[model samples]
Target: MRKFIQSIMLLALSAQLFAQSSDWVYATMTHESALSLQSSHPSGIVILATEGNVSAVQIQHQLAPSLKSGNLHGPGYIYRTDAQDAVQALTKNAPKKFNILDFTITEDMFVNEVLGMVSQENLGNTILELENYGSRFHTTSSGRQAALDLKEKWQEMAQAANREDITVELFQHQLTQQRSVILTIPGTEVPNEIVVIGGHLDSGDWSLQTNAPGADDNASGIATMTETLRILLAKNFHPKRTVQIMAYAAEEIGLVGSNEIATQYNNQNKNVVAMAQFDMTNYNGSSVDVGLINDAQFTSSELNLFWVELMEHYNSTGEHRITYGTTACGYGCSDHVSWTENGYLASFPFESSFGEHNPFVHSEEDTFAAMNNDASHSVKFVKLALEFVIEIAKVSTMSTQELNKTDIQIVVQNRDLIYQFNSSNKSLNSMAIYDSSARNVLSKNQLNASGRISLQGIPSGYYIAVFKDNQGKSHSKKFLLK
Candidate 1:
């Protein structure tokens, strides 16, 4: 009897192992790519069906690492159930044509106000808070908590801004335990036309355990979007087009969250005018300050040009100026691909060039301290996001007339910086200067009627001059220090 009981236990264990090993997931990729994957991992992958250039494939769960590495089919593959489902998803996911509008920078005063409100301290704090999580893996409890926490934070922001109409909700996924967070600010005018900005919230590592910090891989991107949200809410920005900020889940594993959301929007015929993605924004791994993904197959060229033109108009001259270059991220590199694949105009501005992205990503070492504990690099992307949303969404009721009325100007003469304020109702209480990284380098409390300050020791670069008035309102102007 004892021998028979032991044999039964052993057989049960073996059955369980077999079940786990046989677990497979359906995905969509190019026909050639699917064939190549199957050839490379003969027993691990199987081609299910083919429709033109695309093919439905079934991959063993154990071979996910091999699929993720080597950029086999890009950073992610759209998860599906069977060949029929994958084919339907592909057929309905046709790209849409976009009516490219003028990418000009028209809201200078409002844009400047929002850009100046971007705080590196806030960004750093958010990144650190996110890193505190053990690991935001899609199937982990911490991952779901992260999404819930973000939802609460966004709700608090909306309440603080007194925009009670703003709605924040969790977009649950069927495949993953983690949920995506969405915060929407309804437009006063064209509510149907939507503008989206997003980044992944889930982090990952090789072991799929609870050690991945992903501070730069995606925490920085989320932090950037958070800061952007804070400033927009603080200013009570009313836009003509609806603005939605999303924190996607399961991006590290097959871009699952964003793909579902984008597909739903596409099927519902949501008019998403523009979508922007911020990923790995904290690391400056390249010479260029900003690298705009130029993959024509997955990104909109017209939208990319609009970003360049917008930067040149608003951030090109002073310390706020950022250098941009074109780089390509292969198929399904990030969540932007979800929008692009669904026929939406999407763009992704990265921290570095394609090959130069932060090497620490998808590892335990990707921490805030690893990037020198600095949020300066992420600040540039925050400014870019602000520029993109403000210009594309088109402010509706937010008035810059008060700012226009206050004639504040800064002129550089030799080594002295001169400020001229003509508004009689607003008295300049204090003045300060900040560098391109938003670091406060010079500050002065006592203001004389002369309105002159010396910049003898300050370095030559782009700097912003900020003036605080008696009413506690701050005004800023960008100037070149030489």
Candidate 2:
């Protein structure tokens, strides 16, 4: 009976191991690639699917070295987990808990710090430079070079900001020499809880060593995210949770780089609060300014709802009024799926709907010019990305003393500023909106009995929302118009 029980346990372990779907993945390599010999796969390995039984660490050591120098047609290769397989493996028997929204939105100081920092000129320049790289096909020399260049660029930006807390790193993967660039801002309070914003850096035209500018396909995403980082650094915005900005490598071929990174993070039980992805963000192909991907298989509904609420609050009353809609990009179409499969909340905000997406992507025609030589559309994404970070990371300390004194909740609703006072003891005598320089932009001397104050014709900026209570106490809250 003891021997039978032991055999039963062994059978159960074997069943679990074999049933792991993430182990069944695909490799993009020809028969001549060195990875072919290392893989237990048969010949003619063009997009071959294999089930790897090795540990993550063992796989990295066994496969990563040989992958350092190969192209699609040469002795190198790129590998990625099968999208469906990964999703199945990770979600099997997983609880369907909708994580509670547990964050506050108050950071006018951080908002003010970012003004004039997300430069359209700078964004255009970054896109142009990346386009000039000719191609960033995962296995090509230019691809690796582009990744290294981006790493250096981020490092310079951090140094220029004189921020020692920000560390830019190259996250190496086993698929290609191209390493993902990671910029981390360690949280002042909860450093372990993380918020991530990502975009893919590599571009391709379904061929290696080709001129795939991919300006709209992904350079726009990277440039927009870069601006977000620059502004955050410029403002010296410190949050309660770590904020990570990522530029993924080899995304055009498969979700290779991000898959490895997300898997490692999951295995280590990292507390990733949320992840937002920016991809193909420049081309305004649709009527809406942004399209939040609603694919249930590849996105988090709870997190996406937060984004909708954020837009409704910020973009509703601002001069730069942003319009948004929901669309679906199929599973594993981008890197956000990598995080999603690993049981982390992720979102993808695309430039437009699927039917109206930039048509020139993954081709030589995907140039900066293809995006009409404008970074205006992409600028909206930067705004959204920065706001996402602030909301998820939360403020380390309240910037306004009134926030501590009053139970008044403030938000923009339907192009009107609504201030909801929940405290029966607090009666508003007066209210005013002052710009960043403390200049009174809008003022009201009378307050209605309803305990709600609505204002209109206010522009987007950092402002001091000052309310005078009946007790003659001046309560002030820092407010961002959008």
Q: What are the clash counts of all predictions, listed in order?
A: 3, 1
Q: In model 1, which runs have C-alpha deviations exceeding 4 angstroms? A: 1-23, 30-36, 49-53, 61-74, 93-97, 102-104, 398-482
Q: Deviation in angstroms for 396 in model 2?
A: 2.8
Judging by TM-score against the true structure, name the best candidate.
Answer: 1
Q: What lDDT tens digits, residue by residue, belong to model 2 across residues 339-364? A: 87678888888888755787776557
Q: Could you tell me which 10 consecutive residues in candidate 1 have the lowest summed lDDT?
A: 67-76
lDDT score for candidate 1 against the true structure = 0.77
With a 3 Å backbone cut-off (N, CA, C), the pairs that clash in candidate 1 are 95-343, 96-343, 319-462
CA lDDT of every candidate: 0.77, 0.67
Q: On a 0 to 1 TM-score scale, where does candidate 2 land against the true structure?
A: 0.69
**Candidate 1 has what TM-score?**
0.76
149-234: candidate 1 lDDT, tens digit per residue: 99999999999889987999999888788999999999889999999999999898325558978888789999999999998988
Q: In angstroms, what RMSD does candidate 2 have relative to the true structure?
A: 12.1
> How well does candidate 1 score on lDDT at residue 191?
94
